[model samples]
Target: MASDMLLQHLDYLLALAAERHFGRAAARCHVSQPTLSVAIRRLEKDLGIVIVQRGHRFEGFTEEGRRVVTWAQRIIAERDDMLADLERMRGRLTVTARLGAIPTAVPASPFISGEFLRRNPAASVRIEALSSREIARQLADFEIDAGLTYLDDEAPPGTRSVVLYREQYVLVAPAANHLMNAPEVAWSDAAGLELCVLMTTMRNRRILDANMAAEGVQYRPVVEAASVDALYAHLSHSGRATIASTAWLPQLGVPAGFAARPMVQHGPRPVIGLVVPDRAPASIVAAALAEVADDVDLEAHIAAAWDAAGDRRG
Candidate 1:
């Protein structure tokens, strides 16, 4: 009974760490602030350490609190894994998996999700578009179950990655635009065009910037957005163009009056993949996701898109 109570207290601490506000944390835990406060105080007393640095408002956690938070996350994750393993052993696996992905990888997610659902009909899934760095952070925090992002990017320590596909680049432009008739456009040529691109903070944008720089192309985006949808919306309304993964076009369809063409002379195609924490006895959902990922022929989808882009260009 005491052990179970301690687990509940750890839940409160995790909520506080995530929300950074006592009121919000209590709300998340569905308990009164005072209840959460007392539980935390009790936990601190039992642990013999000052966890939170409290004041008139919720101050940050002490160093000990941060360490405790890490332990709490590990313990909670292990608890979940144990439950999942039991369910799997009973041949009744139920799970709600969260997946974080980069904007460019969003198109491929539906296929992956569909496959996962087919395999685990009892499972539910949520996919969020996040930058690579954000995905790495969320994975470390155990806020997300897995991530689909570039494999070469800096990931948190103890991250296990499996390559999915090499992203193929395409230029998305208005159909009437002169560049659309070309079978392929060089990065330097595309750079001269008025562009609508993702914000610099996103890894996709950084990759584009680096590619353009390598090609000695001087470029400035006319519009900058944080989401792929926003960039597409801008492209639809304006004559400006943007670089996007070839996989995006099939899922989103080239907007009416828009054309997608393969980008030639583009530098290396970055390998994107599924990443998860490298923990022993991985969570059931994570293990299933990885198994499904292995069977996903991402390159085949990209190849089909390549053909579609060529057809659109012609």
Candidate 2:
């Protein structure tokens, strides 16, 4: 069979692996069930291997068949990338930028997406708030095109990255709360307030815990939530404060009667940035977004916002 024809059969095999059923895989590929089955058999014959386990229905692939599917994903991905590159050169690459970001880093999504859309008017980005570990998992599974996350020890290995900014955790509380307005607030001091904080399972929370623990302080929050948004809701309704990264301030702003105060420097800043797969991106739109990330001065934008609102103690 011609190379393109063989690749099409591989596509059918991949679809079967994903759907795990013959009829459904055929429907997904928009081909008849028999057509898909024949293609798989042809693929097996061309390679002289039993790529699929025969059964009354779709079962599974042999070991070598799994390897073929893996390489097929790569092969199809690179082919699509090349075609997208050609389209981009002609200014017609329309794509959706599926992106994931840790809740702390969600504020930076616009800085990345704004420039990306401006450069490619035909593109769009959707940002989902997720934990750092979830972001890495999604990237590995090709569930998202790119991610904004802590680039320190938390970043997954075998990924390519460009650091955007060093995150500074700050105290967000009611402006009328005189207990926290100072040049800076120490962790121990912040720990004594009515508090709502992220759950310990989150990377940001772990870092916060490690920092305060080093000072012989342990944060026991009045409310512990799993996500930044949850913590924000608690702070808003319960009239409490949260120790969140500076990234939160520029995006959500403090709720009414609130301000953001710098925390005392406790350790190295958590560098946050854009990360993508080490291999060719599964989507050309992702490649474009990563390229945009490399050039955008998100650090400057974030710093300017932070400086403008430094200790908003009014």
Candidate 3:
């Protein structure tokens, strides 16, 4: 009876648990609906306990099923780690780097991952744009091997974080805006301007708010958006302004007809870095990333890239 169990069955069960619908779970596993349901039922029999709460439609998991789902996640994660370790020992390692990053750090991903890819030529990459808090949670849960986020104020406890660069803030607006001519902009002065701001839930937005508050100002934006692109759209079309970090300028660039002026703030400047789980499992990609980070002059390289992009786009 024990021989009846298979990793594929567990995979099906996990898919079902996540999707919560037989048809959708089957699609996720690239199998037919009946095939998925049958596999899940097989999992229940092998475990000798009812895993799912069956109903006319797709119902949630049973009590035992929830526990099994937790084990399944751990089992899958350990399997990947074991495979990665074996590949490393054989000196023919090929793996994918799974990374989670805060929104502001997304722009700098290419710079960090590019160097790692050069060393591990066969490796692939996947990056999710998440909040700083979510990045820490994913890293802790073993969902993501690494995270890129703000390191100074709220770095996750018991994690190894290496600072890549210190981020400086600026006020970005269309050249046609009145503030564009100034060598520097004050936060109090910006509070009165039409602005497109990041959602308040984002840590980057909170940091921006704190910086503005330090200068005796409160920035009440005319618009709010989840993505930097959306904020840029509003700022560009409506002659509004947005705050950006110098690190992000490398990827976003100063668009034609726009200028980025340094913000004069006596507030805290955030240090951005790469964060990995404390004593993470035997994952080669995460270790390789740490190794690559140690060898590069990341700060100078990103500064040059940001400047080059500005020159081209400005």
Candidate with top lDDT is 1
lDDT of each: 0.85, 0.80, 0.79
What TM-score, over all chains together, does every model reach? 0.95, 0.79, 0.87
Please give, for residues 171-244, the per-residue lDDT of candidate 3 as tens digits: 88777677767768888887888888888878889887887888877767898887777776776555777888
lDDT by residue (1-314, candidate 2, tens digit) is 55668879978887898899999999999999999988988888888888888788767888988888878777766666777788888988766778898877876688888898898887677889888898898777555778888898779777888888888888888887775558688888888888887777778888888878877987678998867778888876556898877776667776777887788887688888889888744467667878998898877777777787854744
The window of 10 residues in a row where model 2 has the poorest summed lDDT is 279-288
lDDT of 3 at 144: 86
Per-candidate clash tally: 0, 1, 0
Shift in Å, residue 245, candidate 3: 0.6
Predicted model with the maximum TM-score: 1
- On lDDT, the stronger of 1 and 3 is 1
| Global CA lDDT computed for model 2 | 0.80
Residue 11's lDDT within candidate 1 is: 94
lDDT of 2 at 164: 86
